[model samples]
Target: MLDAVADLLLEAGYDGLTIDAVAARSGVHRTTVYRRWRDTGGLLADALDAAREVPWEPPDTGSLAGDLTEINRQIVAALTEEPSITAALIAASFRSPAAAAALRSFWEDRYAIAAIVVERVAPGVPARPVLLASCAPVFYELVLLRGPAPGDELAERYARLAAASVSRSGAAP
Candidate 1:
């Protein structure tokens, strides 16, 4: 049921996703869905959780550059791959308090995962802000400012620059 709702939410945006629609798509009773998840927010939250990426394991390649490059690459791929989901969630967040809360939760988890990798690479520097700032130029300029990078080259460049900055900060080196 959650998967069915998630599919609908991803494809149709939050406004278009209805309990009845999910029930019809999933072949489950509307009453059952309502009973299991009483509200749209709750249903959407569950679906988002189900759709989240599993944690990526950090690698100790003895080089922060390589590890961070891989991490950022993965992040770029994941973000770019889900245009509909991102659009729907962003749109939902603006109008729905529940979706805003869910987005907060989602971002927290996403940052936390990245923080772990940053902590491993640079033990002293703070992870969350630094990492976010490092990638902000790319995501902001691409996603918010310009509209996505030209290709993997731009993402790779961002990763390398981020890794270099962290490495040069005189933390672990």
Candidate 2:
């Protein structure tokens, strides 16, 4: 089961994830686990695939800044939460090519759903880069730079900055 996979992966890291451990944890039998998912990467990719189907909707707060700020807050929480699955999966992606691909697919789906927020603000502007501009600092600060979260005010400020950039470039005011 993917639940078992996530738990085991988190407990032991990519090097410790094994069909036997997952089978024991899930009570699914090692043979069944192996037949269904040949290796740790397969299990990781399958978990990401399952996660992609979970229902999600971008924040809709009647303004671009509000929506983007809410999104950044969500990112901060996901990155900092206890037993952080987002952090675990992000780590796994670097160790497994399959996980890397699956993570990419998961984000693509996420961005597509989040695009509606941008579409409501600017009909003709591309949403992907704008969404990146709004969300990148959260990840960069938390993951790469290892800095404390920027918090809500800074999150809102980042949203304001991103919105202003787009607004100046011909998006709706």
Candidate 3:
């Protein structure tokens, strides 16, 4: 049922995703779907939670610059390949508290991976802002700024530049 709901959203976006549609597609009775999910927001949130977890692996790489570059590269790739329904879900989050909370839960895993990299790279540096900014450029370029997506080369360049800037501050050696 959850997979059915997620697929509907992915294929048709939020507006087209109706509980009735999910019920019909999944062969479950509409009442059953309603009873379990209550609303579209609840249904989507559970589906998001039930989906596979993104693994976190911090590459030692012997140098902070290399490790950060690799990490950001993988992160960008992951986001690009992420299901389109996720964007719809994110948009829905603005109107629904349940969706918002679910979005936070999904992002928390990514942040945890970012934190580990930051700790290894720049031990004492505050994790949140630095990590946020480090990844922000790629997202800005691709999503908000509507610029070209950063390829591996550019990701590495940005990561290296960040690493150099941070290293000059005597943090990640």
Best by lDDT: 2
For residues 57-80, could you state the per-residue lDDT of candidate 3 as single tens digits?
A: 667777766776777786567556
lDDT of 2 at 15: 72
Most accurate candidate by TM-score: 2
Q: Rate the local accuracy (lDDT) of all candidates.
A: 0.70, 0.86, 0.72
In the range 1-173, model 2's lDDT, one tens digit per residue, is 89998898778787778889899999997998999888899999999999988999899999888898998888888888777788888888898899999999998898899998888989899988888898887787887887876578657767788888879888786
Q: How well does each candidate superpose onto the true structure, as a TM-score?
A: 0.79, 0.94, 0.81
> Candidate 3: where are CA atoms >4 Å away?
52-55, 82-85
Flag regions of model 2 displaced more than 4 Å. Answer: none
Candidates in descending lDDT order = 2, 3, 1
lDDT of 1 at 127: 84
In candidate 1, which residue pairs get closer than 3 Å at backbone N, Cα or C atoms, i.e. clash?
Answer: 142-148
Residue 102 displacement (Å), model 3: 1.5
